[model samples]
Structures are given as C-alpha cells and as structure tokens.
Target: MLSHTRKNKILEILKRHKQISTQELEKQLSVSGATIRNDLTQLEEKGLIKRIHGGAVLPERESKNSFRSFHKRSEKNVEEKKAIGKVAKNYIENGQTIILDASSTVLYLLPYLTQYEKLTVITNGIYTALELKNEEDFNVILLGGIVRPKSGSVEGLIGSCMLNDISANLMITSAHGFNVKNGLTDFNFYEVELKKKMVEKSDRLIAVLDHTKIGHTSAAQFASSSEIDLLITDSQINDKDLKEIKDSGIEIIIGK
Candidate 1:
C-alpha cells in the first residue's frame, strides 16, 4: 500500500486497539518492522500517537480544535459527502430560498442543484458561491465578512449581520463534530456565530453530517439536537449513538 494509505490503516487499527506492537503491525500490514517503526515515528511527530518500546498508543486525548482545513477534509470522505449531498438536494424545491453553509460537504450539492429551475442560494462559502456563478437559473448571494483563508468561509460580525437580515426556507449545514450533548459543534468561533445566525433566519435547519462526525464534540456548539429540524448522515453511523440522537427527537435521514 502507499505510505499515506498505510498510515491511515495504522490509525484505524490504533483507534480500535488503543495500542499496537510493531511486530503486530508488520504482520497485519504485510510490511517490514522498519516500515512500521517509520510509520510510528511519523504518527508520533503528528501528535496522533505516543511511541513506546515496541508499539504506539493513541494520544492521551485529542484537542477540541483538532480540525483539518477545507482542502484536507474534502479528500477524507468524498463518497459519503456525495451521498449526503444528493439526499440533501431532495429537500430543496424550485423557486425556494435556501442557505448553504461553508462546508466542504455542502459543496457536493452543486451538481444536484441543477434539478432546480429557479432558486435563490445564500451562502458564506466563497467556493460554494463561485461554484454557482455559472448557473443562470440560480440567484446566488455571497455573504460579506472576514474570509477565513483556511476554509474559504466568510464569517465575523459582517456576515452575521447579513444573515440576520434574511430568512430562508431551509438551511443546509455541516459541523466539525456532533454528539447528543454538544449537538452541532465546530472549531472556528466566527463560523460558529455565523451558523447560529443561519439557524435563526431559517424556517428549517438540516445538519448534513458524515459518520465520522457522529459522537464527536468540537470547540464550539452552534446548535443543540433539539434546535435542529433534521439530520442527514451516512448509513455507517453507530447504532447506539444513532439511537440516542433519534431518542432526542431530531429527525434523521440516512443517506446510502
């Protein structure tokens, strides 16, 4: 396997076992002891693991703000995000006004949006607005604010004020992490504020979360489970946590 793919496999194994020996990794991965050692060293340098005499262990705990940039995240779960975006499109109707958040997952909606004959899309995602620029049937409004270069998302007071002035029939958003307790949480404070405003100005709020985000908590809580009108996620979500979220009364739509 490629080095990055091997490292990701190691991470998956570590997540399940908490720790794994170099000898075991070599046996499992069909690689040499030296290769396992090298992977462990790299993972340790990334603060994802702690090296021991013969193995590596997961870090004591991950930081709440341990979020990847938009580019990085966009590559992580492409298939799941595409499935989610396709399902999310079903909620939109022609001639309706909608708010789309500045999330990599939300970007997948661009292709499916062609079904709409006429739509008004308001967004803070720089790339999202640009993606719709060529669609003559859509009226796209790009919100104004401080642009977060890492995520290409517009935020801060200016964007929040702009969101407050407009109301949408529906709002589609994604979060850094989510759980029953924290609901929809994110790493960026400014993005969190803007998302809260989007929630306030929309008639219905739909959180499009991939399975990876389920049961995870981030630095800032934007909306509680009770506050969300719907949640669209992939079918790989854990049954236990899914039950808890369903029990909380939030409607769930599982994407294939």
Candidate 2:
C-alpha cells in the first residue's frame, strides 16, 4: 500500500503489458482514481513513462539525451510565465482560428482563453488539446504525429499536412531561447520542424517567453525576428536586450 511500492507495481505492469488504463490501475492497485493519476504524473515527470489519454505508456528511449521533461520545465518561473500569458492573450480575439505549440509556457495562456467564443484551436500539444477538449465554446483540433513523452508534444511533422487545409489568424508559441541574430530557437529538433510549418500556416506569430530566454540561442531556429509580430516576456528583462528586440521591428510587451 506504500506509494513507492504501488508505483513499482505499476511499472511492473507497464513492463508486462506495455500499456494499461486508469481503471485497470485502480483495480490492480486497489487505490482511488486520484492516486493513480498522481502516480502517473510523477512517473511521467521522471521520464519513466508517458501519460496518454486515460492511461500511461513506457517512454521510448533513443539515448540518455532523449529524456527531457517539458512539465518540469513549465514549473519554473511560475509567476513570470503567468504574467506573460496575460499579456499574450490581449492580442487574441474571439471567433478566430489559432495555432498553439506544446511548449510549457504556452500552456499558461489556456486559463485566460475562456472569455473568447467560437474559437478554433489547432495544436500539436497532447496536454494542451486535452485541457481544451471539454470547452463547449471552442473547436479543438489535435494534430496527428509522433508523441514525445518527455516533451508532452506531438512532433515528426506528420501532423503538419493538416495545416495545408486550414490557415490560422495567429499562432502562440514559446522557445528555449532567443537572440537578435538567431531569433527564436528551440532545443527540440522535432518540435522546431513542426513549428516551422505552424509559422508558415499562421497569419501572425506571437512569442511567449520568460526573461531568461532573452538574448540566448538554442539548438535550432524556428522563427526569425522579422517573422514575429510580437514578443511578450516577463519584466525581468534588461533594457539593452529589450531595445534590440524592439528595434528589430517586433513589438514587445513586458509582463509585470
């Protein structure tokens, strides 16, 4: 009945069965539904499993470098990201089709979207899609692709073919880092590839970032400075970097 022992049992089940539903977990462990969900989240965070709809699956590991936890990354700079989300929502209007990437920071924007109606959302984020699934006022589209457990996103660009049929008014995204020269860069190569299609399909782009990302560059460039219409970040950003981004012809908002 101990938590660790229960989790070990769940892993053993995953090893034997490959995947199991929440109901099965509850029955097998003789625990409440809430406990099973909590254990799954913990296991997913540790890069041990991938949380899918109503169940969990084992992570596919190519190497040690494959285990990047998007949820844990989202937990950092909580107040800052919330502020950025607030600023980002101001540009969004009702009754418009929008694209959203699966970055942890973009997840913060979800809470502020209930005010809008008749909004069509296209996204490759499994967690993001699940959050919006029950909203009666919004039409949610989850793209088809390879799902990455650590990133909690659907990548590999297979879902990008859907973008050719639909165009969005705007797209909201986050990057691992950004610099005046390299623009918005991301550490995930698969995510970067999908975001490129998202950029081409949307009329405008809004970047949601924390101050730490400013003036830094990552593995790949997804958006150049000229391609972004607006950059929203926490107030902790210094003046020089702020002015440089603003000078690049991209509007900027400092969330307080």
Candidate 3:
C-alpha cells in the first residue's frame, strides 16, 4: 500500500479504537513493526495522535466544552494518578507551605500528605479542603473565590487577589492538556488565571499529568514549559515525547 493510504488507514483505526498498539496495527495493516512505528510518528507530528508505550491514542479534543467535572475526571486514569501522587509526595518536606491546584490529579496527593508531620496546604478545591479537614497535623486553607461547580474549584478576582499575598514553597498543578509548544493549557479561563497566579507565587512548580495529556493542546495556554520546575507523568508516555520534553530542560519523573 502507498504510505499515505497506510497512514490514513492507521488514523481510521485509531479513530475507531481511540488507542491501538503497534503489534495490533502491524497485524491489521499487514506491515512491519518499523513501518507502523513510522506511521505513528508521522501522525503524532501532525497532532492527530499521541504515542504511548506500545500504542497510540487520539489527541484530546481542543474544545473548552470537553472539560469534565471533578468527580468524572477522578474516574479517568485512576491508577496513573495514584502512582503520580505517590511520587509527588517525595518532593514535600515537613512543615512546608504548598499550593495544590483544583485538578483531580492534585487531589490524589491528599492521602500522602499524612506522611508529613506538619504541613500547610492552600488550595482552591472545595472537595480537597473537605478531605483535609480531618487531618489534625495539616492546615488546609481553602481559597475564597467564585466556585466553579463543574470543577469544584474556586477562581475569579477574589482567588487571584488572595494568591497574590500568599507565597508557597511548592505548587502542584494539572492541566486539561499540554504539549511542548503550549506547556500547560486549560479549558476554563478563570482556572487558567488562577493557575498563573499560583505559578508566580510558588518557589517551585510541579505539573502532574497523565499520558493522554502529554501531546495534546487545550484551549487556553497558562504556564509555559520553561515555567515548570518538574513534570510527573505515567510510565506510558512515549519515549520520543518524553525525550523531547526533557530536552526542553524540564525535569520529568515517571510514576510507576
């Protein structure tokens, strides 16, 4: 088959299954593994798909309406987020002030915060604040702002003003989608504004993202890759993409 025809067929398969492995594509396309890999690479360059460990998945839709509610997002990539949370805890030292964004990925860090003897967490996530209410050793400061019901997050001028006065040792955040060019992007304008404030006031910024978000670009760009101190993602991230991100000078920690 012609290379263009083969690549088109591969895109059709990915559109149908959302994700397909190299081996499976090889079998279906009747092509060698190297050829399939090349096809995946070319498609990825076009921003059509994101290559994972052994497969490729469709890139996230670049629509603001594609944003899911907090509870709904929590259900997706559960294992990977859990693993990221475990590794994220290693960056925290006892009695340090930290900023946690309202992203579901940051919510996973709540359980791990118990390991610290004394820690203060400032966040805009209502659910996150409620969860930390029971931890005696931890001080949870829920930011005051307009509540975004969809994300269970607080944002607006109030939150931005509050953040201006607060300085944190670290900030843990997540994005709707991120890529080398856009860095970190989100669908909501208010959330993006608040995240910008958080990034500015924190000494270090750590972005916790799943593999699906790696090569995608969302509606609103917030923090650039250069602004982030580190990025924590699942092991499923493609080697080439990971190398490119690392080459950009951002530290990456793979969560097993």
Residue-level lDDT tens digits of model 3 in 145-167? 88878779998778888887888
Instruction: Give lDDT: candidate 1, residue 221.
Output: 73
Any runs in candidate 3 off by more than 4 Å, and if so which?
A: 1-65
Encode model 2's per-residue lDDT on 216-248: one tens digit a residue. Answer: 775567899889888999989999998898878
Where does the lowest 10-residue lDDT sum fall in candidate 3?
Answer: 60-69
lDDT of 1 by residue, 1-256 (tens): 8775677678767766878899999999999999999988877765667899899886666422243466876887899999999899999999999999989899997899998988999999999999999999899999998886767889878888877678899999999889988889875556777888889899999999999989877656789888888899998899998999889988999999
Residue 82, model 2: lDDT of 97
TM-score of candidate 3 versus the correct structure, residues matched by position? 0.74
Query: Which run of 10 residues does model 1 get worst, by summed lDDT?
Result: 60-69
Kindly report which residue pairs in candidate 3 clash with one another: none
TM-score of each: 0.74, 0.73, 0.74
Give the TM-score ranking, best first. 3, 1, 2
lDDT score, candidate 1, position 60: 65
Runs of candidate 2 with Cα error greater than 4 angstroms are: 1-67
**Span of 10 residues, lowest total lDDT, candidate 2:** 59-68
